[model samples]
Target: MPRFAANLSMMFTEVPFMERFAAAAQAGFQAVEFLFPYDYPPATIREQLDKYGLTLALFNTSPGEVNAGEWGRSVLPGREQEAREDIDLALEYALALGCEQVHVMAGVVPQDADPEACRATFISNLRYAAERFAPHGKRVLVEALSPGVKPGYLFASQYQALAIVDEVDRANVFLQLDTFHAQKVDGNLSHLIREYAGRYVHVQVASLPDRNEPDDGEINYPWLFQLFDAVGYRGWIGCEYHPRTTTAAGLGWLAAWR
Candidate 1:
C-alpha cells in the first residue's frame, strides 16, 4: 500500500494543531503535513512528531499573512528576499521534524506581470531552493496552481509544470500533483502521470467538484489509484481536501478505497 499522509493544515482546519495530529494518528495515519509551521517552535513540532510517531511528508513556506488567507509566494516576482526568509524558516522546521518534502510555494502572480520575466524569476528561485535542500536530503516540490485561482500561475498544466521542472533542471526540484488542481487545469490525470512520471514526487487528492473525500465527488479514486499503481509511481499520497461538514465526517472515502 502507498503511504498515506493527512494534510492536517487544510483537512483538519477546525481542530488545534496537536489535536489534529492526534486525530490523524487515531484514524490510523502514520504521517501528517501542514503549511506554515512558523508560529510553533521547531522543538515543539519535533516533540509532537515523536509523540505520534508520524513521519512528516510535506509542509509549505509562509504566505506572509497566514490569517489574511494566503498559501505561499515563492514564485511571485520581486519577492526573492521574502521567499528566502520563508525557505530558511521552513528548512529549520523540516530539519527538526525530518520532513521529506517542502512545497516551494509559487505565490500568486501579479496582474499584468510579464510572463517571461515571471517564469525566469521563479525558475531562478527554484534552483536556489533545490540546491539548498538537496544537501539536506529533502526536495523542493513545485505545485502548479489551476489558472482559475490566479492568473500567470506559471505552471497550470502538466506540460507547463514539466517545463518548469526541466528548466529548474535539478534532481531535487520535483512536481507536486494535487488531484483537485490537476483536474481543474489539466483535465486529464492518467495520461499526464504516464507522460511525466519521473517529474512527479508527491500526489494529493480531493473529490472533484467538491474537494472532499474521493466518495463525495465525481472522480473515481479507485481508478485514480489504479492508474498510479499501473505507472509504478510510489511516494507519499496526501489527503489534501476540504470538508463539506466536519473533517472526520468528510473521510467517507477511506473505507471505500480498495
Candidate 2:
C-alpha cells in the first residue's frame, strides 16, 4: 500500500488544529496536509511537526475571502497582484516548515467573464509561481475540481489541467489528481493514471457522490492503490475526506492500512 498523509483540514476535526498533528501521528499517519496554514505562525507549525516526527506534505495558497466563496484567486481576471502575493506567502511558510509542494488555488470565475482571459491569467500566474519556487527546490501543483462540487473552478478535467500544465511550460509544475473529483467528472481512473502517470505530483482521496471516507464509499480503493503501484506512483496519498463520525472513530479504514 502507498504511504498515507492525513488532511488536518478535513480529518481530525475532533481536536484543535495544533492537536491534530499529534492525533494524526498517533493514528499512524507519517505525514499531514491541510488547505491553508496562514492562521498559525510557521514556527509553531514546525514545532508540532518536529515533535511528532511528521512531514508537512502539502498546503494551498491562500483562498481569497473563503467565506465569500472564493476558493482561489490565481485565475481571476484582475487579481494578479494579489495572487502573486499569496504565492509568495505560501513559499515563506513552506520554506520554514519544510514542505515540498504547494497547491495553487484557481478561484471561481463569473459566468460572464471571458474564458480566454481567465486562461491567460492562469497561465501567466503559474509561470511566475513556477519560477519563484524553482530556486527553492519546491514544486507547484494544480487540481481539476469537479464542477458538481466546485462550480466555476478553472479546470474540471485532467485534460484541462494538463493543457494548462503545458502552457505554463515549467518542469516543476504538475497536476494534483484527486480521486473524488475524477470519479465525479472523469470516471476512468485507470486509463487516466496510465496516460498521465508521471504528470501527477500529489494525490488526494475521498469517496464519490459524497466526500466521505473511502472505506464506506463505492470506490474500489484497494484496486486503485494497486493501480498506483503498477504505474510507479511513489508519492504520498492524502486522505482528504470528511469523517462520518468523530474523527478517531471514523479511522477504521486507516487502521488496517497502518
Candidate 3:
C-alpha cells in the first residue's frame, strides 16, 4: 500500500500550526509534511512529532520574501548567496527534525530574465544543495508548479524538471511529482508513473479542476495507488490539497488505507 502524509499547511486549518501535528496524528496518519516550518523552532515541532509518534516526511526550503512575490530563490540569477542561505537553513531544520527529504523551490523567472541563465543558476543551486544534504543521507527534490498556480515558475512540467535533474547529475537530487500539476501540464499519469518509477523521491495528490480531496478527481487515484506499488515507488504520497469541507470529513478516501 502507498504511505500517505498529511500536509498540515493546507489541511487542519481549524487549529494553529503547532496544533495541526496532533490533529494529523488523531486522524490516523503515521507521517506528516508541511510547506514551511521556519515559523516555529525545530525543537518545538520535533516535540509534537515525538509526542505523536509521527515521522516528518518532507518540507521545502525557505521561499524568499513571499510579500515581494518571490516563491523561491534557487532559480533566480545573481541570488546564489540567498539560495545558499536557504539551503543551509533547511539543512539545520532537517537535521534537527530527522527529516530525510527537502524540496528545493525553484523561484519565479522574471519576464525580462533570460531563460537559459535562470536554468544555469538553478542547476548550480541544485548541485550545491544536493552536495550539502547528501553528506547527511538526505534527498533534495525539485517540483514543477502549474503556471496557473505560479506563473513564470522556473519549469511547469515534469519532463523539464527531469531534464534539469539530469543536468545537475547529482545522485541525491530527484524529482518531486505532484499529480495536480502533472494532470494540468502533462496528462499521461500512468505512463509517467511507469516511466519514472524510482526517479522521483516524493509524490503529492489532489483533485484536478478543484484541487481538493483525491476521492473526486479526473485522475483516478485508486488506480494510481496500485500503479505506485507495482512500480516500486517507496515514497510518501503527500496530501497536498485544500479540503472542500473539513479536512477530516474529506478524508473518507483515506479510510481503506488507514
Candidate 4:
C-alpha cells in the first residue's frame, strides 16, 4: 500500500505541536512530516514519535523568515556556512526523531547572488547534509519551492531540479515534487512524473488555487493516483496541503482518501 503522512505543519494548526503529533496518530497515519520543528524541543518530538509509533518522514532545518523575508534563503553561495550550521542543529532533531529528509530551502535569490553560485551553494549544502546524515541512514531530499510558496524562490521547475540534480549528482540527493507546486509551475504533471520519477524522493498534493484537499482540485487526482501507480512510485505520499476548513473538520477527506 502507498503509505500516507499528515504534514502537521499545514494540517493540524489548531492543536499544540505535541497534540498535532497525537492527532496524526489517532487519524491512522503511520508517519508525519513538518517544516521547521523549531518551536518544539528535540527530546519532546522524539518522545512523541515513539509514543505514537509514527515515523518522522521529513522536517526542515531552521528557516530565517523565508515565509516572510526571503523564505529559505539558505542556499546562496555566501550562506553555505549558515546552511551547514543549520543542518547541524537539524541533525540533533533528525537523530532524535529518526527523520529521513531535511528540506534545505534555497531561499529567494539575493539581489546580487550569482545564479550559478547560488545553485553551487545549494549543491554543496546538500552534499554536506547527505554526508552528515548518511551514517545515520538518513538522506536529505531537496524540496523545490514553487514561486507561490516563495515568490522568487530558486527552484520553480523540475527542469531546475534536474539541473541541480545533475550538478549535485549524488545517490542520496534527490527531488521532491509537490502536486500543487508542479501544477502551478509546470502544466504537465503526468509528464513530469514519467520523466523525472527517478528523481523524486517524495510527493505531496493539494488542490490548485486553493491549496486544499485533493478532492477539491481540478488536477484530476484519480488519474493522478493512477500516474503514481504507473510510475511505480511506491512511497509515502505526504498530505502537505493547507486545510480549507478547521483541521478536524478536514477529517472528511479521510473517508474519500481512504
Which candidate ranks first by lDDT, i.e. highest?
3
lDDT tens readout by residue for model 1, 17-38: 7778778887778888776687
Predicted candidate 4 versus true structure: per-residue lDDT over 1-258, tens digit per residue: 456789988998888777998899887788898888888788888888899899988877787665456566466777677778888888888887777777677777777768777777778887888788878877777766677677767788877877787777777777887888888887888899898887887888888889887777579876788788788897678888888877667767566545
lDDT of 3 at 81: 97
Candidates by TM-score, descending order:
3, 2, 4, 1
Residue 66, model 4, lDDT:
53
TM-score of each: 0.92, 0.97, 0.99, 0.93
Q: lDDT of model 2 at residue 5?
A: 96
Candidate 3 overall lDDT versus native? 0.94
Residues 1-258 of candidate 3 have per-residue lDDT tens digits of: 999999999999999988999999999999999999999999999999999999999999998998988999988999999999999999999999999999999999988899999999999999999999999999999999999999999999999999999999999999999989999999899999999988898999999889999988688999999999999998999999999989988889999886
Query: Per-residue error at 35 for model 3, in Å?
Result: 0.5
* Leading candidate by TM-score: 3
TM-score (C-alpha, index-matched) for candidate 3? 0.99
Q: Higher-lDDT candidate among 3 and 4?
A: 3
